[model samples]
Target: MKKLLLLSISLIISGCASFGEGVTTAFLNKQKEKDLRECRVDGKSFGGMQGNYDGSNNLLKVLMVHGVGTHIPGYSTQFQEKLAAELGLDEMSSHYKEIKLVNKEYPDQDLGVLRVRRLLDQEQDEEMLFYELTWSSITNPQKEKLAYDTSGEYSFRRAEVNQMLKVFSNDTSPDPMIYLGKHSQDVILASFRTAFCWMMGRDWDALPNESQELCTVGQTAVEHLPDEDFAIISHSLGSRIVMDGMKSMASRVSKAQEGEPTSTEAAFITDFQKKRTPFYLMSNQLPLLDEAAIAEKNSASLKFKV
Candidate 1:
């Protein structure tokens, strides 16, 4: 029952539409205002993911991650608004700034921004960047349609959903572990690609020359770190990405220290988060009843990582 409720809440949040007249833009494929509407219609729920990057180099950075279900780009914007309200920051005073890296490495793409309520210290200094990872591309409606028509990796027929439910219900008619694993992995990989690119300083829609190609992202990761402090906010599945990304970047740096000739961009990945970084996780499903023990696995996986 708790699991069902949590799923319902996520759906409700993702489905809510708040259409403001803010400019819609991104790198590699920045669109005009009219194009923004067209693209939104094309993707059905995807409002377009942006890096929320401005030209100025602000130091403190925060990454927001979203979890399961089909989500639109509006999710990020809405989350920012609410976050601002809760923190007693004035949203009207701030605005969204779309940035496009104009070098040969990044493709033209769509980017969005939510410059909301900044946190001010006693020194009256305002410095912190909040980046929301619009990785809903994995659960996007149009993308799902394409994936289903091409390869059935993430497509779930009625029977498949039932089978998955059986696993949740402890039905032993057939072991659905493999089925669940494949679907889960498929979604995770899709999201990982999106999140990884954004973190590595590439646009979310960045097309790599090779599928295995990974950019040295440390410098890019710290580009906006105006201060040594950082924080992360995760909803649902985003927690996994934050933990995994931290580990992935950390491993890269450690390898370099071992004389493995790691990419120069690898040194500062963990450094990006070590300074006074705090994580605020919302809509977390762990406390909800998870019969399959997925929550326990998440707990273990999150252990012992900065």
Candidate 2:
């Protein structure tokens, strides 16, 4: 009798659009507006993922990693708004000049300004930096479509990829490329070539190997910035990227510090104290893998609500 009653309730709940729906449209719309306001006030592009430095004497940095097939600008923008609100940096604005967009494809891109919300002492200036790692193949629509098609799930993947790209671009401009659904490896490679051409000032043929390519991009950005207190935030597939990147970083730092007395890497390590670098995974569906391995890997920090 109890099981039958539960089944009846489930049927009624499933028929409604409200039950089990994650992040309502109304809420998303409001979040969009709030994100724009934060971006404008901070003088940062909504989609900027990596390396935003607020002008100040004190130094802190943040790296935001996006899941597979997502870019920096769109993904970073949403999270930045949330972080700003949480840090109480909403109203403060410094006189520092904003970074300009040099890439024509991404006209809205900018180096973000950090607004200090709290200070441990009045004599100190607090600074923050934001960095992003956007996969090459996912940056361009043509490439994403091709990857989706090559994966043998073109229709579903294309729609998902396009929607994500639109969100990242934050451009309402109509895209005619929406209809070309049949993707191929060649197509994906070509799309990546275009985006990388703009970013690295080189042709698609000159691109580096997959592992080296992503690691170089991420590490280069990290190296260029002021090595100060830093935190990492990754979502969805980004969690995987961040894990890999951090592993690479740890290895590099360890090797470089061989037989040397230094605390540089230590500072970076301390900054990522569990409380500071909190990893939040939303709507995560693990890829084909054993449940035991997943549990073993993330047992310490994993929190499963459902």
Candidate 3:
């Protein structure tokens, strides 16, 4: 009897363990499927080549911009490819290329090369949209060490992207470029200009002087967008740059409205007060501007910290 009882207990324990393992495996499989679904491509290629253009059938254009420490062909490539597929443009290839470092422009100054592609259909008369996406590396050495052990850094990146997207989707205007960040401002600007030229089918030199200017960079790039609505995704310090540019642009417009054609500098100040442009900032812990100035000029701006 004792032996039989022991045998029964062993059998029960083994059955429970088997069941637990099976449940765990099933859960893991589901997670894998979810990840794959997020990354899966769904559209057909536009051209015989590996590039995507706004084919005659497509109506909307989306431009993606990358943030600091990221460039074309990096993780931004994957995200753009996935986004294109999701938007039913699987045939369309990514429009932006990575920035390459050629040589130092001067001592301590790095000159970078930027490559950008246009993922639009030339035959289509679609409205263009911009999507800017960026990520930041923790600056604090101690924080960086802690970030590795905890997935906080990666989680923040994903959260920032999602939050930006939510605001983009809410916008009533047409979609525009999505900007991501990587280190090197010149590279970022170069890539942006290249992408704009490709999308517009215009020469690089034909771009407006205002568009090429550092302070007017974002506005200049977005102004080239075929659509009126624009979405910006900026992280860390990149957010400051975007905000400052917007404020400057707003100041310019305001100045122009006031009939003050004083100078480019004066126009920027005028525009800042006249325009009610919509902007969304994500995970921005640092204050980029005078809090009082921003509050006065851009009271309508939405900020999300994650």
Q: CA lDDT, every prediction?
A: 0.44, 0.39, 0.40
Tens-digit lDDT track of model 3 for 1-306: 999999999999999999999999999988877454356647863332122223442333333333333232344456556654554443443343333322222223332233333344344333233333222211122123333423555446566767555434333111111122133433434333333333332222332322222212243433433322233445444555565445444554565667745454353343434433333444653443345335545545867578
List, residue by residue over 127-244, the lDDT tens digit for candidate 2: 3433343443233544444443334444455677775664454321111122112232223223222222222212112223221112123333323234334455655544544444
The candidate with the higher lDDT, 1 or 2, is 1
Model 2 scores worst on lDDT over the 10 consecutive residues at: 171-180
Off by over 4 Å in 1: 1-59, 91-95, 98-124, 141-226, 262-276, 286-306
**Candidate 2 clashing pairs?**
47-73, 47-74, 48-73, 50-130, 50-131, 50-132, 51-130, 51-131, 52-130, 67-238
**Against the true structure, candidate 3 has what lDDT?**
0.40
Tell me the TM-score of model 3: 0.39
**How should the candidates be ordered by TM-score, best one leading?**
1, 3, 2
lDDT of 2 at 136: 30
Reference-based TM-score of each model: 0.44, 0.36, 0.39
Candidate 1 has its poorest 10 consecutive residues by lDDT at 46-55
Q: What is the lDDT of residue 226 in candidate 1?
A: 30
Evaluate candidate 2 by giving its C-alpha RMSD to the native, one decimal.
Answer: 16.1
- Which of 1 and 3 is the better model by TM-score? 1
